[model samples]
Target chain A: MSSTLRSFGAIPAQRLVRTLLLAMMALLAACGQSSEQVDDMVDFSPPSEGVSSAEKQPPASTGNALQVDVGGALAAAPALPPAASLDEVAEAANRTEPEPLSITIPGLDLNQVPVIASGVTATGEMEVPSPLEVGWYRYGPTPGEPGSAVLAGHIASEGVDGAFRYLERLKPGDQLSVAFNDGSVTNFVVDEVVDYAKSALPFDELFARSGTSQLALITCGGDFDAQARSYEDNLVVVASVVA
Target chain B: MKKFVSVFLGALLSVAFFVVPSSAQSDDARIHLIHGIPGVNVDVIVDGNVVFENFAFKDTQDLSSFAGQTLAGLKVNAAGTDTTAIDAGDVALPASGNYTVFAHLDADGAPALAVFENDTSTVAAGNGRLVVRHAAAAPAVDVKANGAVAFTNLANGQEAAADLAVGTISAEVVPTGADDPVVIGPADLPITEGNSLIVYATGSLDDGLEVITESIADLGPNPTVVNTGDSPIDAGVPVGAGLALVATALIGAGMIRRSQGITVDA
Candidate 1:
């Protein structure tokens, strides 16, 4: 045993003591260093936990690529059976619900004016549009669809005339056109113009969602009451889809 | 060995610090699963992964663990198996809104799935919103709240909603134009304040009948209530012409009722 240990003891005492002191100083330096530096010194292989993140999180697939276990074996379904293929798909794609983008009335000298899809006001009346623009009732139908699509515009706001200021001037056989988001234009022929009391505006016929396709152009008319801040009556131009 | 311990502690501390803020920003969509099909256990698969396993019939599961995301599709499969039952193909789940996925039969009495956009907007102080969805395989029917016809001729896949004072609500269903031999029931359901109660009628009269009522409370604030249709005017009505104004409003309301041929709720 003594002969075996002779090699380790053969080193000079001073050199051995210096070597131990150097090792202790290196350990203290490592302990004083930040964890970030320690991380750089260490090897960080990916975790050994079961599956990798890539295998766990697969990309979402479209349509019917689902696996169906049949008779203890996995089988992919070709596709789910179709349900009202055309209508459902169109509705799901938000296609069939058409929205008007602009309107043109040649009789009233109203060219393609932009339309904003507006809803009922806080007071429950139809919302009026901005100056030089028409307001399409969002609850109503598209111009070409089988229903009454209503559009309202301000007659005057702060002394400025609106796009539908002369809507009451249109007569029967006057041509009007409406453009939709799908770039389709629907032509209409003016049927008649009628003045209704603001309190008596026909709610249903002016905003039907189904039936023969029609359009109702509306604006404030009759006497203006400063106390009420509105006109006494509304002028509505009824038109039908002719083309 | 000391170096390894320090590196491990550093990595753990960094991970712990980063995880807190990321989880706090999570806005997961709320999903409600109603097993409406008769006698079949199901598993809900979202984006190719099974989220709910062994979901049984007439069971309602609120998926609190499902963090909302735009899923490719929501599929229903047989429990413990991969057989696809109903596929609501490629529907967008809003970032953080309540949704109910109805697995019911279509008009032709075939298994189908319909995703209805829920209106969780707040109700009045003492009122709750009740939305009745006719998802059954039966024909057009009338829904009665406390034995009074609230909705008429509601066809399959259509929904009608009304705001009601909070109380125990008794509801029944009958075939269109008939009153007796109730097809569904005179069942009682509780309506809580500031909540939205959705009742779905599933299954057919011949096979089976089931009702899945889901309630979500503490929506927000009351929606603005405004008078709609021909209400007797006092302020907005033109002054100095009461008789003429009344006549015009009556004539206009009558014409609307005749031409439109659909009841407008006042």
Candidate 2:
């Protein structure tokens, strides 16, 4: 990561300024912006042929067909429509319009900004290794979808709490705002707060689509009991975009 | 004097465009840019079934394209939704043994796959090849004399190469509190190579009281909502204590994967 002196150290003054400007230009190359706060991912590009609202959703939960997830002890619940296939998702990303998204909740003093990438930081937060388990997906759909646009932050680094140290304080009815590059600011209100043992977590809940656009926020919570060197639970927050 | 300043500024502006040939590319895959903690984790699923959930960094696409200055002077609501940057990733692993890796590709042509058992009873290194066919398939991987290539020939999307270094990596010198994040000789085992390593915390993250207070005081253009006693409305705060209760049951099995091996050439 060293910026070595150019070969033409004694280049003309005019050329030196040119070089200076070029350095700035090289820096202009933004790796890529990620929408990681949410847990799920859609291609960066929009779907080529989007399904109409009518075709996009399942029939009312008339107790008919619900995508269900079951655990040894946990009960089954309706499932969500899986996002486009992997190929379609990637194609969407290729055509995706990555604009800077930022948000702030005045009542909560919450800042929903900074989408981190793997081994590539935004402002802060570290990169999860590659072929990452869930590489904490950074680019995802806007909230209100039955998907978990998951974003993982570090909690402990040598006896220290990382970015998501105090994620257990938010309550229902709180505000979660999103500001996109298009100048469109959208806010979501907390609707549900559910906790699951990572083993018993309702992966289905994150993607449970019910016609209502929902946003899912997940983080590691519970105690960091040093003895165990791991957290005891998971925090999941479901919210709906402020209509 | 005024003329001299104007000309100097003019010259500076003129040389800005072509003088600097970008030495690096900004195509990134789905991974963190900075190593925050000790390991990397990813849980890959297709349809509804879990294909792989790796907690450690193994074979993954590179996301080093995040080399740029933060956007500034955003006077207007940056509109029109034009793409400012893009990234691509493709990885290659060469070994006589069987190895399988998966990534989320956008479309059928965007992905490819092939079995490398080879044309004859024995697979030859240079003779074996696979292409990106579909999600049901593996990324198009080709074996070359010196190495291998895995990527789409379509010249679209953020295409990056995942280099798998095959060899005995030196034992890692993990952070033992006494060491300064780095150690001597084959330090940072399993994951060998000269590339930076990142670790993600398992619990929620906040600046804590003292850390948060300092962050606010030093709020430059880049504002980070680090936890502080003064900022009661911090976004990092968990929705409730219920999360702690749930974390207990999931931490062990929740660890998507244990150790994934990867090597990056410096």
Candidate 3:
């Protein structure tokens, strides 16, 4: 072989040997895996037992894509169905029978004992102006009278916490209901929730008998006086049974 | 040199073969396996019909189990899907142990399922309820339990939903250009008295669907006729005012008769 050829072969041989050694060193360096990687892999162990979390949990989906957008969580429903055009839902809701109060407000622990005549003030006894709890306080002189059918409740109490704990949160339009003895129920929509002191309650308007059917939810609010021991004020919700 | 190279390449080939297979085997290792429910067996029944019984799930089974059962549209309980019906027999009699029924792969309480036996059926649960009366006259939804009825006069349409709960409530919306209410109140509205019905007088007059006593003489003051958009709900409850009037009238008549003719006192 020529001297030139021999030198060239020798140079190529040296470079080849160097490249292999570099590759080997790189591979050895990688052999020491990262500690973080090891930890993630260990945690790759399937999740522990199932847990329902309160922290904003993404809703779990199990059905076809169109599963009524439960807003994902079972606790809450989607936004209120759009109020149909008056022409749309014009038909009066068919209420065949009157239903009595079905539930108590969540926070308050009030007793709703059924009695025919709402206990009148009788001059001496302090008239329990409001219901023990504030919900649908059914009242009537008769089922279909144009007379005043009064109702009262506590805006807040430690027991029920407040019959209308959410009263202050009410907007102009809300709803209410009362059950009649005639297997018929009366419904009312809230036009206003006015907070007043106990003495300021519209005694005449609230306590008087009216000509047609109506309902009121009374509760004490505005101010609570520790000395008087009663709410300094009251919350009066005025609603009328839809005509 | 050739021999050395050959030996080194052979070693590389051996390492690749052994290392690859070892990894492949480890990848298949399942250290832990848990079935959703103990014994994870299930049975499904619908409308007194057996759909699936003690069905064990086969891994990778989308829905049907080894029992050849399909569950996607099974009608469950409470909030159960209405797509299909599930029966008591189809449930895995969990040996009488308390088992949580989770809907849609849930692990909690079973949902209420609605059977659309008629053209329209309402499916509701918890604070949510839907009432649908496929029939024309009768109320589509009747709440026998202590729950709320959110929708009434639920018109026939897809968007007609209700958010009724358990309690007495009234909801009425007057259409534009409706009647001006008869203004029945002292000053403000919705006054509740023993004999009087309270209402907030606003907007044009929107009529109610209430049933007045058959006899106007038995009614209080001026009786406004109730508007019924659809057939009235079947209720035998008479308007209370009539009964009160009859009682009062009878007492008055008896006193007058005694003054005019014969009474025990007279």
Candidate 4:
């Protein structure tokens, strides 16, 4: 809606980058890799580079394995099942309905906002997110599934910046992390950013249930119309699995 | 021929595994049975089970729990009685397909059943598909959408289809010969995007013709097909035959070498 709202709420881009670089350096140091590798590991390129390089890397797994392995007194834990390959994990995702807990975006300085399943309204419009949380279309595929998983949040509400206030500034290669209810996290790299007229948004492409796995983040953007009390366009950020 | 048969069977088996039925808890087939026979109530039976009793004229029953494919015997009898009126024999019901069966009088005034297959193929973004079936005992008719003929001269037991932009449309049924005397509507019908809307015109003109509407939603475009496209011939000279030829050639060379007392590597 037309208002004097501006994104002074979100952290600055350079600040976010420096913080992320420091965090990646810490993680690399913990993993026995030199901090110098942080430059190559967390390189924030455009969406095309993210997609092509994602194809060359292994599935992103950033959990604290050492913490799990060295938690307590030295009693042997039960033997675990053979590890599954990336394809096997993706295939298995089809049979499971993993509930998402929160979403984190390092590039935008957006962290851990709760997510919940949502349905369309009686008037046939998708249910919008709360002022500070995101909503996932319940009828569509979930994240990690072999389809486009949609997440929508409010950019601004009631003349205040909402959770996705900085979503319009996200560039390709920005990393996004989603935590599931089961404590598992998935990493994705932004591939594309598009703004479509509100009347002509691509529903099929954003909600397809059979194709390459994708996560689409949507929010209102463009000039706000005072008469209509809504934005004229919708910003969509498309991302692919980091693996 | 033997190799081809094996290859074909292997392909079929592979497709069978890939087609594991949609695991969504609600992937069952949705079917609607419409009683269009004028003045006579009927009982709809499927697979020797009476599913709808005292099904009155112009009534529609939705069979929502029927799942998977099966050869189901469909018979319509006088309401609340076992006297057979129209026996549709066995019909196949496929999974995830939405269907409508209309029981109405044929052109000869005899009771008959016409099954309409609803196409649920996904339409382009912001579009929908509409299909009209002429199931009435009357002559050919025209189905108009927004005052224009979308289906022309569709006779009894025939159907026509058209793709339309997503929106509410005013549709009507008229005799093919003239645009006047609109029989059905100027009714506002909402055409949902990515869905198929089916309208069946049933009953005779003398008995008050009516329109029955059903919809099949969630028809998204299919995923890309994986094509190996290689035939058995591409396997190159059968393994057994090629191996035998090589063996024969090796034996001939061995014989020549042995006769000359030349040692040959095995």
Candidate 3: where are CA atoms >4 Å away? A1-117, A124-144, A157-160, B1-266
Please give the TM-score that candidate 4 achieves against the real structure. 0.43
| Pairs clashing within candidate 1 | none
Candidate 2 interface CA RMSD, Å: 29.0
Comparing to the true complex, what docking class would candidate 1 get? incorrect
Report the error of model 1 at residue B74, Å: 3.8
Q: Model 3 over residues A56-136: C-alpha lDDT tens digits?
A: 233322122212221122112122222122222222222233434321221222212222233433231223322222232
Best candidate, TM-score: 4
Per-prediction TM-score to the true structure, in the order listed: 0.38, 0.29, 0.25, 0.43
* Superposed model 2: Cα runs more than 4 Å off: A1-93, A118-136, A139-146, A153-163, A207-212, B1-266
Predicted candidate 2, C-alpha RMSD: 27.9
Arranged by TM-score, best first = 4, 1, 2, 3
Task: Please tell me which model should have the higher DockQ, number 1 or number 4.
Answer: 1
After TM-score superposition, the amount by which residue A217's alpha carbon in candidate 3 deviates from its true location, in angstroms, is 1.1
How many pairs in model 4 have backbone atoms within 3 A of each other, for residues 3 or more apart or on separate chains, i.e. clashes? 0
Q: Give me the displacement of residue A12 in model 3, in angstroms.
A: 99
Q: Give the per-residue lDDT of model 3 (tens digit) for B61-170.
A: 11111111111122222222233322322211111111112211211112121111111121121122322221111122221112222333322111132333323333
lDDT of 1 by residue, A1-243 (tens): 122123234443344334323422332231222344323222121234212322343343110122121101111212122122122322332434556876767656554566788665434556655555678876557676777878887665544555665667788898788877655677888999998887677766677666778888887777766665667777888998885
Interface RMSD of each: 23.0, 29.0, 26.8, 37.0
True contacts kept of each: 0.00, 0.00, 0.01, 0.00
- For candidate 4 chain A, the 10 contiguous residues with the lowest summed lDDT are A1-10
